[model samples]
Target: MKLLKERIMRDGKCFEGGILKVDSFINHQMDPILMKSIAVEFVRRFASTDINKIITIEASGIAPAIMTGYLLELPVVFAKKKKPVTMENMLTTTVYSFTKNRNYDICVSKDFLRKGDHVLFIDDFLANGNAAKGIIDLVNQAGATLAGMGFIIEKAFQHGGEYLRNAGVRVESLAIIDSLDNCEIKIR
Candidate 1:
């Protein structure tokens, strides 16, 4: 987590409107070593939880989730933003993308997510908790138990972290940005 915070300070780009672009390393173009380190940290953080499957939204969350799943030796399932034609008996939910500024119908196959599954949700970022809420809905629809949620970066100023925590969700964020006001990155 310390490594992540330092990397964010060095390479993360701060834009107006509370946007922190970490594409240089974290999301778009990835650093495998750093990602491995992050996966290790996540494994350590949630070692005690009973997790059978790892869930993440497609696109950015895939890398970290895969790494974490590999380390944990657990199956990883990513919810597709666009439901494929072949996908059947799927659990679907709507999620608003903070970055894209649009709603996406995210879904997963019922074969992948099912009742009695203890799942851990992983994602690239958490700002408004919309995606997280969507994941929760999908998990609930499947009758699966959401064990925890992991995030690479969390904008604390947005209060998503507070909302999830207050709702009794175990949320872990490696780098928490206290503020991204006036194109400045402040880490908490």
Candidate 2:
């Protein structure tokens, strides 16, 4: 975790709207060694649990999810941002994104999750916790067990982390950014 915090200080980019762009090594052009290290860290964090699946949102979360899923030997499922007009599911819910400033629907195939299966949610960032909530809702609809949510790097300066924690969710973040002053990382 110290390694991740140091790397974020060195390479993370702070943009407008409190978004930290980690495109240099995460979110865009990825560093495999760093990613594998993250997987190892996550494995260490959840070693005692019976995690049957890894669920994450698309784009940035894909890399970490894949690595962790491979490490855990579980199938990784990403919730699609847009549900096809023709897609069919008796169960569906909507989540509003504060970052994008819009509301969108996310769907999970009914076949992926089964009752009592533990699923660990993984994502790149936790700005407002909308994505995490969305995934939790889908898991509930399927009657599956909610294991925990894992974040690669969290901006603790924001309320996303607290929101989920307050809702009684087990949240694990590799690096917590206490501040991003003048684009420099401050770890907490």
RMSD of each: 0.8, 1.7
Residues 80-168, model 1: lDDT tens digits: 99989886788889988777988889999999999999999999999999999999999999999999999999999988889999999
Predict model 1's lDDT versus the native: 0.93
Task: Report lDDT (CA) for all predictions.
Answer: 0.93, 0.85
**Which 10-residue window of candidate 2 scores lowest in summed lDDT?**
84-93
Give candidate 2's error at residue 44 in angstroms: 0.5
Best TM-score goes to which candidate? 1
Model 2, 1-188: lDDT tens per residue?
A: 98788888788878765678789898889998999999889989988777899988777898999999998889998888877677676346688887777888878778776787799998888867888888888989899988898898888887789999999988999998887766566778
Give me candidate 1's TM-score against the actual structure: 0.98
Q: Estimate the TM-score of every prediction.
A: 0.98, 0.92
lDDT of 2 at 73: 88
By lDDT, the best candidate is: 1
Superposed by TM-score, candidate 2 places the C-alpha of residue 126 at a distance from the truth, in angstroms, of: 1.2
Instruction: State in Å the error of residue 86, model 1.
Output: 1.6
Worst 10 residues of 1 by lDDT: 95-104
